[model samples]
Target: MIFLLLSIICSVTVGVLLKLAKRYQINVMQAVTWNYLFAIGLSLFFFKPDFSSVSFSLISPVYIALGILLPIIFLFQGFAVRQAGLAKTDIAQRLSLLISLCAAYFIFNENFDRLKYVGIIFGFVAIVLTMYKKQTSSNNKYSWLYLLLVFAGFGVIDILFKLVSQLNEIPYTTALFVIFCISFVLSLAYILYLAIAKKTKIQLINFVCGCILGLFNFGNILFYLKAHRAMAENPSTVFAAMNIGVIIIGSLIGILVFKERLSKWNYTGLVFALIAIVLITLSKLHAV
Candidate 1:
């Protein structure tokens, strides 16, 4: 339970940090690039993932896909937080489970209960409502696209992760480490290109911000995995608690601390998101 609490805090903190980045004039791309460096360091220190047994040929495609997607989606998330606010951005991220659910049904041939179906329907509705903005400015309209991309990007990443987990030749930790390394190299290459071609000067503050982001990002994954291990018998509990806790906590912080405005429809969407998650959890429990 304590691990679950810590995981929730760390997850929400990532969004909070992204939100604060704009105020501090942090370069998100540079910060994200450095983030993978610190994440790789932490992964090596803690997981110590063994790669000797891994068949690189067998895992390369999925690994490369994940490596390409991780940093890109992370950047999208940062932009989404800056544009859409933490409350909606978090909800969009969590609702990405809907996409994964569909993939399970079609690609993986997994079955879902009626509750899950209803939940998926509600999840779509929530996405549409939560992304709704009152402003009619072209910039505001364009900004909301980031939220859509966040929703879709995380979904594809989730599906790819599931594919990685299914491969028996590679350990999950090893796969994670490799993906992080790949993301780091790609991000660094892009940053260097910007430096040389666009004359974008890298700053120390961005590195500092990235390191902090890396800590919370790694902490979130560590504690969530620990919580799952701690409650191995009740997997649905961990799933439900993680999603609900983040949505609730992130929304509170966005609205109260940041004073992010939300319409009546958006508030209703939040409630629907909660209900959808509960239903999906119930479906999982029923399957068990």
Candidate 2:
């Protein structure tokens, strides 16, 4: 439970930090690039993944795809947090499980029960409602697009990671390390391109911010994995609690601390999101 709680806090804190980045005028790309550096270091230290026996020929394509996608999705997440409020961004991200569920049904040939179908329906409704923003001349008028990208991007990443997990050639942890290393190299290259083409100076502040962001980002993964190990017999409990906890906590922080306003429809959407998660969890439990 402690690991679960820490994971939730770390997940929400990543959003909070991204939110703060905008206010501080930090370059998100630089911060994100530096984030991968720290994440790579952390992965090496804790997981100590052995890649000597890894078969790059077999997993290179999947590894490369994930390598490219992780940093890109992370950048999208930062943009979404800046354009959309934390509440909406977090909801969209969490609800991305719907995409994974669909893939399971269609691609993986997994069966779903009535409750899961109902949950999927409510999840779609929640997305539409929560993303509704009143007409405003503000620059954030198109923020909903960023929210959508965040939702879809994460969903795709989830699918790819699931694919990686199905592989027998390499351990998941080792695959994670390789992916992170690749992400770092790619992100660094982009940062270098910006420096040369756009004359964007690599600032110390961005590095500092990136390191902090990486700490929370890695912590989120670390604690979530820890929670899973701690409750190996009750995986559903960790899944349900982590998702529900992030939504509730993120909404509160966005509304109260950040003063983000939500419409009545948005509030309704949030309620429905919780219901959707509960239904999905129940469906999983019933399946077991």
Candidate 3:
């Protein structure tokens, strides 16, 4: 669907922008903090989320958790791409589907046929291969932690979003607004702390970059949710499409646009990623 395609493009664009930010010497932390500001503004202006419809009596804990978690993981992602490479960080984030798929089976009690089983198992091999590199930084000893955090953080966030979506009482836009508002508060506080305590100067370029990032970031979520709603009966279809598209585009951008190198093992992992997506999607089709 067009929605899924747009979501994938927006997601990859965000990664590419972050990668470019490092080279441009932009203040990523400041930009990210302000990104929440612009995202909140965009949500209010376009979505115009109804707050009166939301009540504490029917509050979802998932929303509360995401408010803080979203910004924290966002910062981790920036760190991941900057410290590791774009392709590596992109794979880590996209591979989060592995965790979500496992959760769906064990925790959510979703059924998976043999095809899904094969796909899930193959994803692990892809992850190990993706992490392999010919020559990493001397900082490789601990730097991988950033990429690992991005992987786990996004998985947990996806789980929380699913939980929120399942609740019929909570309007999705309202929940999103609440989450963004909390993220804005936390991010703004951090920015203020840096200004007062660390004396880090906030630059206009940060807000400029934040505005651009916010448009794509908001579009990513908007289109993703729309795609899911359009294909509600077959979520795996959207999931497979989104992950595969990001992995493919992200890899291409990193390799061609950014001139980032990947080892043979990494390329092998990418091939496995495509296979996993096919198998997973086929399992959904078979179920249907």
* TM-score of every candidate relative to the true structure: 0.97, 0.97, 0.94
**Backbone clash numbers for all candidates listed:** 0, 0, 0
Which portions of model 2 miss their true places by more than 4 Å? none
lDDT of model 2, residue 47:
92
- Please report, in order, the local distance difference test score of every candidate based on alpha carbons: 0.92, 0.92, 0.86
Which stretches in model 3 have alpha-carbon errors above 4 Å?
Answer: 56-59, 134-136, 139-141, 230-234
lDDT of 2 by residue, 82-126 (tens): 888899999999988889999999999999999999999999999
Better candidate number, 2 or 3, judged by TM-score: 2
TM-score of 1: 0.97
For candidate 1, give the lDDT of residue 142.
62
lDDT of 3 at 64: 77
- Candidate numbers, best TM-score first, in rank order: 2, 1, 3
